[model samples]
Target: MIYVNEAADPRLDDFRDLTTADRRPDRPGGRGLVIAEGTVVVRRLLASPYRPLAVLGVRRRVEELADDLAELTVPAYVTSSEVMAAVVGFHLNRGVLAVADRVPPPTVESVVADARVLAVLEGVGDHENLGSLFRNAAAFGVDGVLLGPGCADPLYRRSVRVSMGNVLRVPFTALPDWPRALLGLRRRGFTVAALTPRPDAVDLRRLPDGATGRVAVLLGSEGHGLSEQAIAAAELAVRIPMAPGVDSLNVATAAAVAFYELTALAHPGHPAIATPRPRQRTDGGTVGQ
Candidate 1:
């Protein structure tokens, strides 16, 4: 590991000016490089599929990640906090920073094959919401995430930090199949439940009755909720009962509540084994592109 005292070191370009460096390429003044701040996230990124370009930090922070950095063939630029802040444009309390190219996730079918409860997202462009969904999914025993249509990348720097690096731990796949692709899940005996606030829809608590096989929960963007196509494709639509009219919880918060209810419904021990849930049909074909 080669170390440098100057923040101007040419080898350290990847970790420079992180505050605005992570913006999308399409956005004005954006480089779109995948960035990871803090020791934990940087370490995960190094371990992830994305190849590490370089790392920059103060001496203490770099030393703290010595174990993680041991296998890397990249440069480790060590400098004073003053220099680091100046070069990065903003003071990063996390101390360490690593940058790498974005590595896309796998396709839909492989991600769903061995999963139980999967979270399918559509039009969830909010990074924080997406990250929180992955964190909640991991906490409640959900296996993987399927980016149905418009979900943002879970590997984005902010998402990684918000998820506390759980995004690296949980696998995610992008599904190009819109509503039509859900047919593949049906073939796998998955009862697709779209989480909505519709009154006529089945109650969220009423699920898991005979759900012995796989299941997928479809969620939509924060602004407009699920698309009509997504809702119509699912076997049933369910919603959480709130006090009178509490508008609705944030997408991630709503997901947490739904997860809690779903998990309880699935593992309700002795007294709840006999509850009757909507019948699950193993219908449809393999997911097509």
Candidate 2:
């Protein structure tokens, strides 16, 4: 590790003033670097496909990554916490940061080619929600994530930290054609199910369990949910049964529930499936009181 006491060291430019550094290159004033914070995330970044640029951290934190850095030729700049805080533009309690150049995401066709279940997102622009959704997707063995329009870049620094770096592991790509691209998935034998709160939708738990065939769960933004055009493109609509007067769930939380349900239905032996939910009637009442 190279020791540096100066915050203005020319080599440390990649980590300077990070608040706006996470923007995509297409956005104004963006470098499009994938930044991983803390040891856990930094380690995952190192293992990810993105090429490592450099690492900036305190000496202790840098030493902790010795094994990971042993074979890597990139520079690891070790410095005091004060210097790190100044360079990073904020006092980072995690004390370690790693930066990498963004790589091209896999093609949607490639991601869908070998997947049993996938998470298809639309208008989920919140970084934390996107990150949490990915973490849930990884937790439930989701094969991949397909980004529809109005989605945020999952590689943003906040997203990377929030996802515990699972974004780096999850294969995702943009579907620039919006709802039209969903037709391609349907043609490929995927049952595109849009998750919505409409009264006419099928109850999520009521769907057949231990089912066969590929499924894609379409999710929408927290504010407005899925667009009508997008929902119309789906093969079916499903909803999680909730208490009366409750409208919906946070998109990521709703996704976790949906992912778990799908996984349980497809693979009954999966350990994370919860206890069976009570059956509900078509009129929104409990069955066989």
Please give the distance, in angstroms, between residue 83's alpha carbon in candidate 1 and its true position after superposition: 1.8
Q: Can you list the residue pairs that collide in candidate 1?
A: none
Give lDDT per model, in order: 0.78, 0.88
TM-score each candidate.
0.83, 0.90
RMSD of candidates 1 onward, in order: 8.1, 4.4
Using lDDT, give the best candidate's number: 2
Q: What is the lDDT of candidate 1?
A: 0.78
lDDT of 1 by residue, 204-238 (tens): 76665655456788999878999999999998898
Error of 1 at 185 (Å): 1.3
What is the overall TM-score of model 1 with all chains considered together?
Answer: 0.83
Candidate 1: worst 10 consecutive residues by lDDT? 268-277
Colliding residue pairs in candidate 2: none
